[model samples]
Target: MKNLDLFDPRSVMDSDFSLNVSGGDSDFGFAFNDSNFSDRILRIEIMDDAPENRPDSEGCTSIADWARHRKRRREDIKKESVLDLTACPEEQILNCDQPDMEDCGDCGNPDEEAVAMSEESPSGDEAGNSNDSCWSMDSSTVVRVKTLHISSPILAAKSPFFYKLFSNGMRESEQRHVTLRINASEEAALMELLNFMYSNTLSVTAAPALLDVLMAADKFEVASCMRYCSRLLRNMPMTPESALLYLELPSSVLMGDAVQPLTDTAKQYLAARYKDFTKLQEEMMALPLAGVEAVLSSDDLQVPSEDAVYDFVLRWAKAQYPKVEERREILGARLARFIRFPHMSCRKLKKVLTCNDFDHDVSTKLVVEALFFKAEAPHRQRILAAEESATFNRRYIERAYKYRPVKVVEFELPRQQCVVFLDLKREECVNLFPSGRVYSQAFHLGGQGFFLSAHCNMDQQSSFHCFGLFLGMQEKGSVTFAVDYEFAARSKPTEEFVSKYKGNYTFTGGKAVGYRNLFGIPWTSFMAEDSLYFINGVLHLRAELTIRH
Candidate 1:
């Protein structure tokens, strides 16, 4: 019986009160003839027919029926009220029948609004009242009905829905009877929601029950109850099952800001649980669109490169949507934005243009955008990444890739040469502690592709842990090419690129060449703050390669 009053602070501190002084065990603490309430009746009609049993009831009996009923009921009531107003001006009609409450013309006359003893319907014309014609059009449709004496003023104070229904100058507003139609599944939740409107508390604490009440509150436009339910659900133990359920809530519920925190938490949980996409490929593929989006949206996903992410997205899309058109639509619309095109390999980007899964115009635009981003200067690219970070645009954000992105500037004048720049954040370099290797994206020189690799390994000469760098040809078992290459790095005090190694090698396909310990210092000293190497949390290295005649 946890009571959370999110709307009014006073309601939180106030003691709970019962609707009936007699302590009745009814669904709502409803008691007739009590002076503490108003002279109005709330008739909740429950349609208990199962979906398969009722021809008119759609498969979504609970939601579709409840929503259609609410909308149609309001419209019908307003239209009838307007007709009644036109037919009889300057007259307030109170249409109450039944034994517990009496109908009256004058609201101020207590004698006319007297309380009776029996529970029975009026006969003849009174029973065939035109006001109930629309609701009772299909008598068999309504399986059960529950009548309760409710205070319009009290309900209106808590929900705008009731306020508009009761105060909107409608004949139904002036009338003593108000009818609400809902399915049998909504019976308990609707009752809980009504009780909450009166007491600002809920007796149901379980997650599933609270969620049901939350949906009911949303249907009835009770913001406070939704917030209370969201808070209660958030406090309960969350599982992947429950998290996915929260994320998959109806769009109508998600539209409200009150449930946003709950969804955000769900997305975060899914993202963290599946941060390593490589390890959970099958599981991630099995996730629905929302869950996949949650995982891919995170900047923390661990993969080899953006190419792998693109592969996974394609595989998942293909598996989920065997139809080519639907697959293209989903990838182009929902999933494409999560793939960091700017960070993908050039070879992969080329393949993207020919990929049939993406719309031609969309894939072209993305490739052009990625190329433009790659063409920008290093500092300009950093600025763009920083700017896009504010909006959480995943295209510009770099994930933890096993192969880091690099910048390469090619030149034809120096006998076909290229200067490759590899910048590793201080933390990234730190992650290479003891013995770890990180490779850079491939660059082109002399019509051949090459890559830069950084490592932490035991120095062959000193037999101590030291930073290492290497140059490798992307091709394997191919024609050999002789090249002179130089490695340089920016150091403290000067912060200028200082040449470290100068050598020539006849590189065969699949062969690599470089010094084991380029810095010629122990790993600890090279990584120490105020060390000659790192500049402003970045380890900048440059490799210049020139084709030999």
Candidate 2:
């Protein structure tokens, strides 16, 4: 009998099983308690659904459905895993070595050959016969291929063309692959060229290398690439050695379209590094006038430094005789009329007369003709004035002002006068009394006029009196008077007046003692209207005058 423990799985499996077995075997001797028999009879039934047959309405639903879904998924994975085999090599089956298999009769293996065939041939002739003479000579003369040791992977990847040309197999006569060979002297150049070819980058760190690359590009007929290298060199400061080397190159090489930009570059380099641009200057001088002109006309070559540029121009100008002559002739014609004589033999004048030596004596004639053509009235007048003034003489001065005024009167008077009179009646004293009489007088006189007066006293003690007057006119034709008065003893009379007045006047006088008289005449009545005159005593004297009307 076994006691089954539910906690123990192995015990549970080993326990006996029945429908309702009680404590122990019954009295009827059923033998139901036989553990071995129960164990043999007991079959535990586990009724779990198979994975495919499980209820899966919420998941896979059915076995066929799940199989089809899995098959489709597998097909998708296979499709994804499949590789494009177009570029891939076809698969080959490899034979395995089998030690037990016998070689067939037709096989060439030594061990598989028939015994008779093996015995017939000596020295393993089935394998192959060796000619001792051939083997000995071949062993003695055989040449081994030397292995190439590439130091750099970068170099290994270079064009095979260069590799073959540089390899040990190359012969001297067959070494035309590279533009130039890489000797120790040319190694820098080769590296620079390789660097440019590989990466299209210039190595500025090594100036010599960069220059070598330039030379290589030039030697290889890579003009565009050469131009690019030249541009790089141009941006850097060129040493004097380089400048001289550049100057020695043919002008055509530097002046080509591809290298046109380099022409200015070389010029700038020469200008900066070379104290004397004799080489470049010589080359420039050798160019034709037209070619030189073209170079000079280039905007890049137009240097602003006046002395340097002028020196260049002067050299060019001296070299070109025809242009200078043409310019001289043009300038001569322009200046021929302006230059004066006696100095005509001077440089300026002689150049004009020569007319740039165009014609033998025609230049002199042209000068004369120009002088004649330029001889207008005003110019002639100036010439005459100059000639006349060349010498100083009083006669010349007089002749110069002959028509001008000799003496001009800035002030003058008109000749005219007014008069008034008072007469004494009969029984009045016949003898005039001029004693203590204040004469009041006014007159309008113009042109030329004068006053005259004479009087005597009745008493012996009385004095004699005399008067004279002159008149002048203003700009508006108003007249003024100037008076002169004289007094003397009655016994002796003098014509001279005692006092004289000269001004514009108005007259006022009181009663006359005996008789008083005033009278005047038009200045024109007594004097010529155009007369120039002065007064002497009581009369006017005339001088020469001309009246317009």
Candidate 3:
């Protein structure tokens, strides 16, 4: 049994479980009602469920045997330490250790005096003080964790878990000592947990046991422990392949955003590796369904074609059922809907059906049908019926058919500029020029010259041409750069306009300027769908330039 209150309410509240004792030796020796101190009340505990804490009838160690063991163990320690961790240094206690001792502090209540000193801590803030209270516990109020000594008031103050335990009427409230049996898993992390409780210091070297420490913190409801553990995991020199283990952490251990660091690390790694077929093997196949869902839903997953998605799905399915050949179809029925069948390359679709024995009837039929209906073929692409699966499945089926990788690589523009299409309402020569905010290059098409420009002076124009939009490139004098650009017709360029640049242009300024009637579609095309080209006083322009060439 260890005593010295590990007084840290923050550490206690953050963990899901902890070993604790209520009143210290002094708090319990207050000479309460002798009649009420019956067997039921006297039965102390290490933990409520500990073998020694339960009674003999419950098949725990018999009370006599448990008592003998404690006596033997107590004898192994100093006679003074028999009652608690504080027993070894009782001379300084405010007259509470001896039965006839009188209080020495100004406060009448022993507990209040102790609480007051701790509330106004004597260390941490002042390092020069040789008598830092953090190091010198009032021997009568110490918590003994194996060999480690901790201050009771400091532990109680920082940990809600310890505060409630030491509060009156709790099962352990009257007990003088409580022993914590650190499990095998927490063996390496116990010191780390203690360091944070005592001084709010956690060594970065504890990264190896972060998961173990995090789980222990979760059990003890030690939120700070969880946070520091999560911080350590976040700061690790992490890699995608190494994050595989993090992805496998039991959901129970993912406490209070404690696993957020690991989660973020795994997401970045998985998204980056989503395209690598070999990388998906072994580790990826071992990922549980939730991990699979995470990778499947991300836009950052960079596979060359959806076939890679199909290939990995099959690989993961096979890995999951290495010995159970018959389980493939069953598993596929549950997971195959994530595969975007119509988006795969023809060769990939054929490879999957020919090489893999696992059969997904609907998925196979969808891919086979997609193969025959490619644009150059005789049939139109067919979609999975909504009735056949979930809404996600139907949506993916449609997305697979419509998905188009950008023709031009997109890059971020240094800044945004608005171009009003109302300026292009003119029947001809609907000319607009760059505001010089975005630089431009000199180029020509149809024997006519053009320059890359952004929308400007639109707010000043009451009525103007509906189509004079120049969306790509930034030039410096003679060099004309080719840039991937996009445009949107907006009522007002709101913050969301950047993400919704729906039309694209990728052209070498001088030679590819034939289609340079920026957004080459005629004004009548937009007039028919008037809402797209006009709103409020004048339509606002939004665009982005990506990939300078």
Candidate 4:
């Protein structure tokens, strides 16, 4: 009886699906190649709007204008994702010459148009009267209706959207014919997606076309197609324009895992290209928010200091957002996190506290946190930097600044003394082997300028390389100053600043003093993996300076 039911022609005739016994000679196999096997017909209604008449059709002369256009287009197309094809009456025709509702002062609200586009109307009058936008079909605005024979099972296997639409027990799911409406710009992309659903390959090769398909795939929830599009785009040669476009994609599309790698590559490209921020100031100043964010977030930015970063951010915010409230909002929310407040100078931090550009509460909190970080001990600061995760706690992580930061504790009661602390990573010391030096920014004590220098020096007696520390006076001429100095380092078993050398020296203009080999050990032994001087891949040094009063 079951076999008889299956063989009944009446059963097959009443069913929405068709079974084809004959095979075809195509690579996609019989089901994909035979039109008789297609279960559903997709009628795509393409609405062609005049480019000159579009509300957003103005020529984009700059990246800012282009960004705004992209945002508006994103908002306009969001409704196309959840289109209700069954709601439209078969006999009704919509005119496309409706006033540009966006420019219309009396048309309820622009968002109401989006709401009307996505929703189903009870009757033609309701759909016609609610908002007659571009999605509607009429003889004047409708370019053409593209009819395609599609297999529901094949499409359902590739996209959850099709699967749900076919199996969700809706009236449209039971119907033999289904309809879709889209702008003429999306017609080629829609056709490409359908072909990909059948053969798992796309015929479009250009980046712009691929991007369209990627967005269409995202709208239709086709993960595989989206990944394919991303891979192809990443393989193509990237330009600044294309890279910014990738970074500025709608958040919904950018958040997908399939497209993340492409966006990351774009970010890295921009970061590398604009690494020397000082040289490219003019070019970078014109960049939109996404491009600026990409450039600023890099750890390898070659700026003089975080002070420069703060100034650039302020300038950018002012140029982009002239309004004070909007500028403050952007600075507080989007750009402030990348400034590395803890690494900025005390002077800049003070300016931050008094600046009216930032919210009072936010500036106060940032300044307080920076001050606390500055007060932390060298080891405590290292711990904070090491423990911070990549996402939320990057404030403690230092960038490659021209002038390395130092912690100084001054004492007025103890005859004008200052204890300066400097920490270097093992790799930084390793890079200085044979003959190299690293300098700290100048510190002042008793109206005298001084700096600490670490070098790999040759011990004349032993004729071998060893690590050295020196204290130098920046002033020149006949002025002579006397000072008591001491150099210490943290070692294994007890990571405390143990005194390595101490001496009293009278300094003249352009003069320096210190032991040639501070550790009294060869470079190889001092830099050995089991060396006692290194604590957790970091070399901590402290210098105490006291005036001989």
Candidate 5:
């Protein structure tokens, strides 16, 4: 028997998923490919809404629209990772028209090479057919109320928990009886789990029992069952029901096996929807310190400004250490560790300093730093970073602060960013994003902040001696930024301004890529707008960072 690859749910969720939007076609169904399974999973035939089931408001829309509408109703497809395959490549498209069979090599996953279009469903007879062989290798064991008569070899093939029980010289390995501490309701799910172990196919009705069986499998160390359960929950919409379900699940069940279906995905949905996140603020605050820190450190926090973050932290700290009248400094400092103090505007810092609620050594130091940064201090004292913020960077979902005004701080981000400016004197690109790239006469952000650099791309044949944009950082060492910041060019007197461009990039560790011509023509306009200075070889460009997402 050939060994099978470990089951990866992402292959099913991330693979090119298509909805045939051909004119008035009701015969089309959804198809999915799973590398772990021998063949493609079942092609679910989308059923047309019956007259009684159809809502009066839709006005009998076309079948395609109705199908999509129905699919959306069943589950929110936001959790599903999708690639746009509407523009099928010539090599992948067998026929443009909605034909019986269509193979698309791209769209579902950026890395997928081929699309499996077969619709045939696998049968039980195909999975674990060697019953005699399985029986000869091992014996049956009674776990709890459920007595399973399975091929020891087949059961151990994928389940390390079973393999250990049967192989280790433990009491269970010698005896057939293996008692379990599971509930009565879990018996059915266990049976279904066994059936799936034997047969690749699991019935749709098994959804209700998925979580239960998943926990049991996890207890038994069945990696596949855990993945399947996570996929099922992740595949559900990020709606209240789904979010609540995920929240209610055991932390162990929700943690990452490979992909963090609950922890990361839920945070993503919440980040995208600010209102939802606010509503969960109380519950979010209740999470472990690390969890709350992770939530606060994201660039996609959807807050209007860093002010919101300060308020949130204050609320959480007050809740955690209520009546901090005596040890106010201690509690305040403890909670203040996560705030990107230097990211706050001068006005905000002033208000916070006088607020008495934040009268701590850390707050005083941050205010002093902000004042110095605003003054564009000639020498920064030290590169300061939010210790708590650094802990959040190693995971997905980057944390960013919003400081539209000339904000500067220590370079604590994980990825080192160097903004390359036109060293017109050398005819070579120099790292400039971190103004520190050029000591003396360079822009400084107090102790720790981003530096200016000319954006240029070699392959694209672009270069400019002008302005740059500011980027948000989760920490100093990050290779790329998750939050996008817009760079704009504006001048005084004439006040000529160019449209802002978003800097979307992934950087190599300690490396920087330039935005060579500042999104085309805009650079030319900015350079040419200040015509007198342009001729004099002098240009003043100001880049502002706008955190929209």
Candidate 6:
């Protein structure tokens, strides 16, 4: 029955699938759909549990069989004896009963005595004890002494190299581990560097040494010390002179190396002192142009025309000026405003004054006119030539304008009147104007009342009027209003007051003040009979006025 079942296609497919038959005599075998023959065989081995019908074993070994074989072989061998172990014990353990005679007789223990003796001995002392007596007479004796001469363990622990270097008296006398020298510099720099090295801090009051210390710290590779020094240097306030010097330093040094050291206050200091630098630069430029020509032409070469002399000096000074902006500013400030007229040669002056607004030409013209009016003939020909030149330039401009036909228009303002009065009633008729062109109005009230009234020309093309309205309210609920009026005339007409109002107004304490006007009417008028009301112990009133242009 089972063989018949195996013949069925479904039963054969479901049976343990195998691609290869090992022990069975079948030459051909069914192939499985999946290619994994080892897994298929493993599944067959798992399902075939019956001893007689189990899958034929081809190349397989049991772990228990191998272990039993190994156990039987191991059991046939003999174990070695460990009772007579040849390992040697330490010398101290071997001589435990023997009294340690390395120390003095009264010493509690040899090790302790040796340690005490080593500590008490001087740095170079080697005769404190001898180990020769304990050793065989024929055996050679070797002595070892280890000495650490560190004075302070804490300092030594920080840096063993430093500790060792100082411990051996290497830093004794003037031959210290670190040496600093300031060459031809102010004492401040030397002091600052010294303070940083010794105490890692600088005196707050030391001015000159502050920056110098920073430079020194950067030179030395002491990171922690340099950080503290940099902080102190950054905090120091610089005077104007120092600030200028600071600005003159190398750009690389200022921007790259020391930029982080700068504080906001220091930056402000530099800004404030910028003018001094500007002046300095100007002076440097001005001096050379002053008298260089005269100096070149002088017989003595030393005493030239004041201009030439000034020019030479300035040129020489400018050549020596630093290239930095701060230095340039100093030079500029000094030279720019300095009076260069006295030292200016006539030729130079002419060249400079050739511009439309030449100072020399103006001054020369004034001098010539003074001479002519005084009946002095100093240089009549020169004076006449300058006068003609001036007249020609003026006429040239005038002709150019005439040919271009550029019109010049003038604007007229409206007439205004302001009036102030004291203790005037709120509804009183303060003043009156006859029927005329009412252009604008404004008012203000404070300690004194202020009012403005403007009248404009009705025939103008376009006109505008502005006014200020200010009102002050008293504790008694009484109010005062003041106004100011301004009128402007223009070519383009704006919308009449009939359409829009053109003014800003603000009201406080429930009181209002503003200009009022109406257009398309016969005339603008203000009446004193306007209504007034009182609410919540506050006075409410309406003041209306009509203005026409």
lDDT for 133 in candidate 6 is 20
Q: Lowest lDDT 10-mer window, candidate 5?
A: 92-101
RMSD of each predicted structure: 8.2, 50.9, 19.2, 10.0, 21.6, 39.2
| Better model by lDDT: candidate 1 vs candidate 4 | 4
- In model 6, which range of ten residues has the least summed lDDT? 37-46
Estimate the overall C-alpha local distance difference test score of candidate 5: 0.40
Name the candidate, 3 or 4, with the larger TM-score value.
Answer: 4
Clashes in predicted model 3: 46
Candidate 6: where is the Cα deviation over 4 Å?
1-199, 223-237, 249-259, 263-267, 275-549
TM-score of 5: 0.41
Per-residue accuracy of model 1 over 1-549 as CA lDDT, tens digit each: 011111221221232432331122323334333323544666665554444322221232333343344343333323221122224433322232323334433222332343432233334463335344323333434555566656565566556566655565644455566666565656788788888876667998766667778877776677778878888878877667677777766535333887888888889999999988779778888888999999999998888889999999999999999999999999999999999999987778999999999999999999999999988865677789889888967688899887798877778984788888888988988989888889998888877889899999998865689999999999888679899999999875465789999899998789999989999889999998878687667788999999999
lDDT of 6 by residue, 1-549 (tens): 112111222122123421111112322212111111101100000011222211111111332232233234332212211111113111110011222223325322312211211222222232322221211212211122211111122222222222332233321211111211112221333334433433344563343334444443443323333445445545665654343333332222323344344433344554343323223434334422322221122222222233443344445544755444433453344432232332233334344334322244444653344334324221332354347455512111111000011111112234222222111122222221222321111232233222223222121222332212222332223432333323221111231112122332332334534333322111122221332211211111222222223
List the global CA lDDT of all models: 0.71, 0.30, 0.41, 0.72, 0.40, 0.28
Which lDDT value does model 2 have at 235? 70
Model 4, 49-116: lDDT tens per residue? 44532323235544345445556576556545244323432321222222332344532342222111
> Which has the higher lDDT value, candidate number 1 or candidate number 5?
1
Instruction: State, as a TM-score between 0 and 1, how close model 4 is to the true structure.
Output: 0.76
For model 6, how big is the CA root-mean-square deviation? 39.2
Displacement of residue 268 (Cα, Å) in model 4 is 1.7
TM-score of 1: 0.77
Better of 5 and 6 by lDDT: 5
Off by over 4 Å in 3: 1-169, 183-185, 204-206, 209-212, 251-256, 275-294, 323-549
